[model samples]
Target: MPRSALISALLLASLSLSLNARAETDPWANYDKVLKTLPKDAAATLDRGVSCNHFSGEINGDNSAADKQTFREMKKLKCGTVDQDIASVKNKYKNNKAVVNAIQVYYEN
Candidate 1:
């Protein structure tokens, strides 16, 4: 193979690897990824008394539409679409709910 062709093949392989690693290419994998983000313990409240089926603190409130949109873009890139359905849970009691979905995120000082 020519030197240029070798470089092109390498570049293409690198690109494919990077894309596959960053995005959840599989639908079931995406669902599992989101589910994994759910709080392990019992936490988060549903408005309609609906059980907490979907959950994730990974990109919950720690992200901004403009400031940071990696998570948002990832879903779109992977599934070629986005899921707009979102539920907000407020832990007013500061009880076990707080203990369950405790996020230990840190921001720049």
Candidate 2:
């Protein structure tokens, strides 16, 4: 191959590797990608529950009273439908072990 072609191929390979590494590191992103392969309604329901349950701790690493209150409020708002969503997804994909396992691993509360 020509020198330019070799460089272009190397760059493409590097980009592909980097994207794969990122997907491996970010479980949420990888789960979303997997969910996209499912039916729209199932994916939407599962994604909603996953998004509701997923959150990071405060940056300061303190579990203050304010943080606890905020978390409780958020749980009431966002987690109200989580159980239903999980059940719906489980029923919809029960025949597919891969889908069920994905839900168990990534989306369950």
Candidate 3:
């Protein structure tokens, strides 16, 4: 390859690696950062809600002991409050699109 072509290829390869590294990063880091900006109660409520949903999704009729344990722990999270908290958070952050969207994305996942 010509020298300039080789340089361009190296730059493209470097950019690709950088993008892949970012793609593999822990999404929760960003989520946690966003939650940290909220009031303590709001952040806790949201974290619990997300955690509850995460565990709940793991449950099925053919559950292993660990799955049952997860279910029990999820129950303790009081998922019933999640909907109310979500509504409250949405209303409270209605003016902040980033906050609202982050919460929505966390729940959706």
Model 1 error, position 59 (Å)? 18
Compared with the true structure, the alpha-carbon lDDT of candidate 2 equals 0.73
**Backbone N/Cα/C clashes per model:** 0, 0, 0
lDDT of 1 by residue, 1-109 (tens): 9999999999999999988976754433443343355454212222111212222233456556642464554443332211211112223324534323332111000
TM for every model, in the order presented, reads 0.28, 0.52, 0.68
Which 10-residue window of candidate 1 scores lowest in summed lDDT?
100-109
Please identify model 2 stretches exceeding 4 Å from their true place.
1-26, 55-78
- Write one digit per residue (lDDT tens) for candidate 2, span 57-84: 3323477787776577657646677778
TM for candidate 1 is: 0.28
Question: How high is the lDDT of residue 3 in model 1?
Answer: 100
Per-residue lDDT for 27-66 in model 3, tens only?
6658878888877766787788888888877887687898
Worst 10 residues of 3 by lDDT: 23-32
Q: Candidate 3's C-alpha lDDT?
A: 0.79
Identify the leading candidate in terms of TM-score: 3
Q: What lDDT does the true structure give each of the candidates?
A: 0.37, 0.73, 0.79
- Models sorted by TM-score, best on top: 3, 2, 1
TM-score of 2: 0.52
- In the predicted model 1, the residue pairs found to clash are none
